[model samples]
Target: MLDYHFQLTRPSLDTIAGILAALFVIYSVSWIIYTRFFHPLARYPGPFWASVSRFWMVSQIRGAHADKTQRELHAHLGSIVRIAPNEVAISDPDAIKTIYGINSGFTKTDFYTPWRPAWCRYPDAFTNLDEPLHASRRRITNSLYSMSSIARAEESIDKCTAVLLEKMASFAEAKRTFDMAGWAQMYAFDVVGQLFFSHMFGCLAAGHDHRGYIRSLDLLLPILCAASVMPTYIRSLFLIGGALVQPRVMKALTSLKDIDEAAEQCIAERHAQLEQGKSGDEKDILASLFAVMREKGEKVDFGRTEVKVEVYVALFAGSDTTAAAVSSVLYHLMKSPAVYKKLTNEIDEATRAGSLSSPIQYKEAAALPYLDACIKEGMRLHPSVGLTLPRHVPAGGCQIAGAWFPEGTRVGVNAAVVHRNRDIFGNDADNFNPDRWFGPDAARMDRYMFQFGGGSRTCIGKNISLCEMYKMIPELLRAYHIELVHPEHEWTTHNYWFNKPSNVETRVTARATGT
Candidate 1:
């Protein structure tokens, strides 16, 4: 009674709809069953939803902080938790070596592909896909990020800090609540500008985001974060280009284009200045980049693109991350008055003893044990990067937490997860207690500190951030007695990827004496 002619191809609308719906259900059920019961990672403990689908992971990210979610997941599921069907978050501090260690054969996942531009076919230092090529890129200009080289620009750092202090003093005089979060961002961006171009970005001087760079990045970051979860660069690019955000709006925002254009303009200007026999700070990043270009360009394959990537990475890394970190130190200090007093007391003692200098030399700040402890503790509680540092397994399988992971598996350790591990950081790790850094575990804790990441891919601009934080935190605390405007409320932070703290309203008053 059934007409089994090729009616399936030309089915009625209702029949077609019914068939499609049925097929979708069948596919969905099949995928869930396979992913949960037969996938290589099926044995790992995680949320029931996560075991069956990646949408669960994406939904959690859409809903809350990935860092906190990951930490809670690890706590519930033990050392390893399947964050997604294809990804696992390892909380074991010891696993850092296996995952991110040099020569570990665990290369970067596709998460970093968006950082590279299409024209620049070669991978720069920060791109995660090509380790060997990027490693070579790192070698060419590693000296530019060296402590000594960054120290050469100490005068520039001092100038930026002085300007920043002047702004703080104005806020103290006005008795106006300081937007410490915004100011920290300005100072960081201005510092990077001075370091690269022999001039500041006018952000600190303007007392707001100059040229809309900060706002643009802030607006686009969520879209970028969402795109990051995509499986490939093309897919992520499509999402950024218009899949998630409107094309016109994305075009209006200057995330990569602004940085690239700035790099191009700066390089062109520098080259013209060079042609005219004008010289810049030899220790400045641009000068060092040029030096490497002339000295080892062919050997290391350094060129205009490499220079741009370096400048791009420096500005991108230095500004937002350093800003967030500086804010963290300030936020925690305001929240925990005891820690604040102890740190300021140390600075006061050192100042009275003439051990501290104006601008607070990096060495001087490094010498203050309590100050150091406070910085370490703040970063531990809130690392800048919230996502797990995902790495792809190589040809041979590797062991982690006593389990063998097959090649090409995605694995990473979230800084928050490891930083708060009770076994490693002790039971009080969840609290902002700086005293944890004073004992025997201090060295071990330092080894596990993923605030700036680990292994060969550790943040190269770390000295810049360290120098800024080490110098500025003590300077601000000693010069101005700061308290939270809303002492009862914690600063607002959204951990889409970067746990950038904002809503930091602090009242500042100038102290009578540094001593």
Candidate 2:
């Protein structure tokens, strides 16, 4: 009886294994056939492996040169290139309006899902995928980030700028070649911190990333970019693996927790001030937000969580972007001595004419055409966000770049690719030339500029960043004689979310007056 039972079970196990192996082979062949020949996007051009798997996109992003890779792909494979099985990168200028314009019906894709903070129950304005919800959020927050609001926050910015100048002076006196990128980030963070929380983050004072916020963000961005292209199940598995294998994952989480705690503390302090009748007529973002909440009453309520999350969004979104822009502008200016001299001459003229004040004012800076051109040209050449701003083709589908894309396709425009189009930006599109922004085709060039993005989903912090750049760049140039530490070699960059400069080391000395 025992011998008969053992024999029967062994044969059954063997038969089951054989059946499973056959099923695996069949599924693999079917998937390959579908992806290669039968998929909706199979007609598009891309690397062979990219057409079959998301791994290619992942590899490009992981390599930190996805922006350059996408540009090369567009150069070789026309405007539309299949980056992933279901994703197409569009670089045609005409496609901008179709994909991102108001009422375009192209919603943000799941690629943004990983951008939502782990602490938030609801997605913040930047990460909200649903169009209606995003619209609602944007509507509520629009007033707070408007140009007028940024104008009101200019004093806070000026305070931080003073600190930055003081820090630079110390560097000048010490005759040290400092990491300008780190200093730019510190300046950005301090300015945002002061504007939002009524406190400086003290990064500049500390002369280092004391809270590890920068490092945390640096680690987190790559992970998010990598996970964005992954299948949901696979992404989950990857995250689990990351937690087990990578200590940086935990550091990132801890950094977020620290940020949340700091925000809560700020909120608590504000409430205490309000209760004690010491909440003066401050005009910072926190004050403006509270004013809105008071006016709305119970009709449009904002809970503690909502307020905290909004503050988190302001800090996270505002800091790195402005820093990258600052770094890009400075790097380009250093690279092109002619452009730098032209820009500094503009600043000096403004100062001499008494139109610009010490630390410079946003309004006066706005009036400098050459300064504006330099800022625009720098942003155009090296946009902070390196990856494509992805959007989903809405139901019923739509035409994009003169072709009809089916519903549910992921379409996006990479700024790096679009900005370098020779037809739109001219033959010198790849070169850094501020003159392009001041030419006869300036208006036409403006139409394709995606530095702050375009359409309804444009960056809410655009005015804030402009305010910083417009003021700070002029101030720095006017006060210091700066030179790149390695003028012979080009600086390196690593693109995760922001195309961050890796080695923006520079030596600074105070400029002799009336030179």
Candidate 3:
């Protein structure tokens, strides 16, 4: 009777569920088969399983040290290698110009999409992809970052440098053991704040963690790593179900909100200055932006949104990157005392002649062959923003390394691979050798250095960073002697965005500088 009723009416609940499950299995299988065998991109050579396997690629990226993995793939597969069904990893140095150089039609892929905080009150410069929007925003503030303006801001740079020196001097006076990482990071934060917002983090005075800048950055690191490796679909799911499943995302969003709020306050202060009819040149980055806006017109089109984006970009590019480079350079210096001694002697001589503070300039500093070599070698050996900064090929498609890549293909040049190329750099490529950057070899080395990237998109702050390091390194060496507390200490680098230092502690001691 039950069977008769089931036949006469609708199917049983269990039977319906079984049919649905079977259909789902069939659809998934067919999709995989079609993608692997008949898809438009099937001709591209990659790992057989990875060609149609999103989960495989995600797992590979999620595994430990994905950057090194990409390097190995480049070594084995040559310049152009398929990393995933839609991703190609290019190791050729020329690709840098093609990908990130001026008028490169490629745009940032969805890899950066999840970096947007849910409660973000501003458009972060790092996350903006619309070319026109990016161009407009960059244009409004480009003058502020121009070489002439940066050169004129020398007084501000000197002031900040003095602040850093004073802080280091205090540490020298104490003769106490503390983490160099903390101090270096604090100096970076202070410099960025003073440069951009016309304030300081006061981290050095506190001799502890400052929640002002570092706190927000620390919270965002893991999410940045996770987003890079995990599938976008998965991240979207978390974002969509954020209310229920992703508490950490909510916390990060709140922290970003706090950061934006602080930036808005700074902008408000600038507006007040404008309202007060303050005239002439301004010192910090925001003031410069204001001056440009005023020159353009009294009623420039920027609202709070524009201010937020510019601030976030300044915060991201200025602070954390500076911190990473400084910390890594210091790490290499301390580990190799010979190198440290050479650098210190140069600084000592420069300071004795009063060049450390007086007339300290990026051009002059960049001319210091030893210091330049040390900086480049450090960046090459331990690139802070290691791994691939991915870009998507345009609709017409692209050709790389004598191979045809289809439209919409995700592509990136692995920095580590290019810098460590045995062909270009030799067998000791992995070793830190500053001498390789001296004399005739220096010109050759320039072709492969990928730390600041290349062409028009090369870091606008490279000049600024050079000036800061040129002054700071000399001053710090003159006052203090440092040894790695953990000689075996290693920083964590990933295939994600930034190569971050894992929490590490280093010891410091005072040096007797005969002043």
Candidate 4:
């Protein structure tokens, strides 16, 4: 009886062990097969490890060394690189147009959904992917940014520009070293507040840095990288669940709440005034938006959630990015004295010739040849958005740089790579040469200097930003000359959808231009 029982149990145990072994072998074989042949990206040419791994992509951002990686990849791969199995990085100008141009059948990738705050009323403002929805939102905001509106808004512009000039003059008079980068932030925040919310954050008045309502929002580069590691559904989990629960994420939402609450209050005040027939020609983006909505006979009450989000999006977008571009241009100018001196002269000459006093006109500032050169050169060398905001190919797939790619392939144009392309800008592409802005030379700027991106999705706020910078830079320089107190100063950078400055430190002392 003992021998019979032992035989029955032994066979059953042997059968179970064999089944487990076979399952393990199947999984191993399937993984190898996927990496070797079944993967859609298996046919693309790239680094062997990169084709099969997500580590390289995440590591670049994780190490805060994306610039180094991009430079290396471009150096090794020429104009086109298959950075991942499904994505290609194109550095050529023609390819940029081919991939990002209005006709290019590419749309914003699903990667942006998670970066959006949960409380966003008009979540569709910046996060929407469908082309028609984007168009509709653009229509609502377009009038506020029109040349006529900006011209009409010149009183506010003058007030803010004057405030900045006065502050710089004080620093120049005192001969004290101050934080120029910090001041730029203050100026930008204040200006954006005045224009968008009909209020001022008073960052400039405070002198020192003030953590305003918008300070908590980090651009979510880490999340973008994590999402890139796997399929779209898996990426959604990281953004929807993982990111929203993080402390930093919560802080950002809180900041947004502050801005929204304040904006809603201000909107209420403006609407009340309008209802009372108190028409004294109020100034601000909110005032104009309210006016437009009223004229259209749309009365759904002011301070609606969507209205608040729209206001926040415009304020946040206008302030930070423009400030960054302006600050970078200033930093580069300080580093290159020849460029600085040249730009100063251009600003002086243009302002003098025009005799502009109250509000610096964009039309006049746009004519400053050297100033234009300096701005273009600065944006090219250090783009605000370092990574190409990834775009998805249409359903039928598309051709980029003469290569046929499958549908839904993630494609992007790396500004860092394209801006430094030797083929278009010549060998000194990396240098800050403002001379490139003059004559037919400026007109010859390659299509690839997509600092603001390209096609219909290009920045809608370009005119407003350029107008502000065009005025602000000249006015600030007119009041005081700036020098970098720490000549060897360096700032940290993070690789988000935006190329965020990390702990950016600088001292701004005033100097005369030896006029």
Candidate 3, residue 444: how far the Cα is off, in Å: 2.8
Q: Taking the tens digit of each residue's C-alpha lDDT, what string does model 2 give over 1-515?
A: 99999999999999999999999999988987898899988888999888878899889888999999999999999989998889999999889888889988889988888778776756888889888877876687688888887887788999998898888899899999987888999899888888887788889889888977677678777787888878767887787677788887666556666666767877788878988999867778888777766777256556666777788777667788999999999999998999999888888887888989875789999999999998998899999999999899989988888788889999999898899999999999999999988779999999999978788889988998999999998998899988898988888889887888868889999987833
Where does model 4 exceed 4 Å of error?
1-38, 43-50, 53-56, 117-125, 208-211, 219-246, 249-253, 256-280, 297-303, 351-359, 439-441, 502-514
- Candidate 1 residues lying further than 4 Å off, grouped into runs, are 1-20, 233-254, 280-282
lDDT per residue (tens digit) for residues 126-219 in model 4: 5777776677666766777777777666556666787777777676677666656566667777777777755567777777446555364443
lDDT of 1 at 44: 94
**Runs with alpha carbons beyond 4 Å of true place in candidate 2:** 1-15, 118-122
Per-candidate total of colliding backbone pairs: 0, 0, 0, 0
lDDT measured at residue 418 in model 1 versus the true structure, 0 to 100: 89
Instruction: Compute the lDDT of residue 311 as modeled in candidate 4.
Output: 67
Q: Sort by lDDT, best first: what order?
A: 2, 1, 3, 4
Compare the candidates by TM-score and give the number of the best one.
2
| lDDT for position 50 in model 4 | 63
Superposed by TM-score, candidate 2 places the C-alpha of residue 502 at a distance from the truth, in angstroms, of: 1.9
TM-scores, all models, native as reference: 0.93, 0.96, 0.87, 0.84
Question: Ten-residue segment with the worst summed lDDT in candidate 2?
Answer: 296-305
lDDT (0-100) at residue 447 of candidate 1?
Answer: 90
Predictions ranked by TM-score, top down?
A: 2, 1, 3, 4
Lowest-scoring 10 consecutive residues by lDDT in candidate 1? 1-10
